[model samples]
Target: MKQICVFILVLMLTSCEYFNVKKTSSEAILNEELQTFNWNDVDVYPTFSVCDSNETKNEKTACFTQVLTTHILGYLQNKSIVVTHDVTDTISLKFQVSETGMLSLLNIEADSLIIKEIPHVKELIYCSLDSLPKVFPAIKRGQQVKTEFELPIIIHAN
Candidate 1:
């Protein structure tokens, strides 16, 4: 009788459905989703009116930069700021384009002599940037985003 009772108890425990567990596929699903995720690289470069009709990304970027450089240089040259005493130097200006297509000056780097010689250099840079044509901000993941630009201004004094 004891042996028969032990056998019955073991059978009852094994036959219960509560002891069964199933594996979930969450790991596999997560891996698949990650494979389809898009990285944050810019899909489109910022555009100026001169670059608006460009067909390719590289062309648009190049044209935009060239046009911007021309505008800034034109302003400086017109103001007679590039004339110096036989010294050649480069001033690096960092700026940004907002999502709403406005230019803002961020920072500028120049030599001590250049800083002393150039009156209100920051103001001049701000004015130049303010004079730029409206831009179409860079696009990332199909949304407009602010972008930074670094421009090198080379002053060649003869």
Candidate 2:
């Protein structure tokens, strides 16, 4: 009788899910009902620059800074606000872009970690988007053609 009573108690304490198996797939969640970038229409263009000076006194360097800044901050202003877990106005990142216009993710170079005393609080970090290399167009009959654009963003949460 004691054994039967223990079994009954256990059964009563167990929730309906305790004995059931779940059948959800990660792929289904990855492709969650959302639209993604239209990679097919993306363009890549190179900015011309003089290799000697840190300051861009030439046309190419100026153009590079302009485009790079737009791509980097544009996403942050639109996306960072909705990062949900992000409490700060900006998300910091550590990244490197190859000389050939390929963007690489380095790390989240941040000094301050999240504080638990305040809920949803975040900190700002630095990213090298400002120094991203310019991709020059290919020369065809003394002309150039635009090709592609690539940028990577990194974030860390505590």
State the lDDT of candidate 2 residue by residue for 47-109, as single tens digits: 544332334334444465465556665544543333336443233444343444454445543
Misplaced by over 4 Å in model 2 are 1-57, 80-95, 111-134, 137-158
Model 1 poorest 10 in a row by lDDT: 79-88
Root-mean-square deviation of candidate 1: 6.8
TM-score of 1: 0.70
Worst lDDT 10-window in candidate 2: 117-126
- List all candidate RMSDs to the true structure: 6.8, 22.4
Off by over 4 Å in 1: 1-40, 82-84
Instruction: Give per-candidate clash totals.
Output: 0, 5
State each model's CA lDDT, in order.
0.79, 0.44
What tens digits encode model 1's per-residue C-alpha lDDT throughout 1-158? 99999999999988886777876699988898879876545688788887878899999989987888888778776776653556467989887878887777788888777776775666776787766888888888778888888888886545
Q: What is the TM-score of each candidate against the true structure?
A: 0.70, 0.29
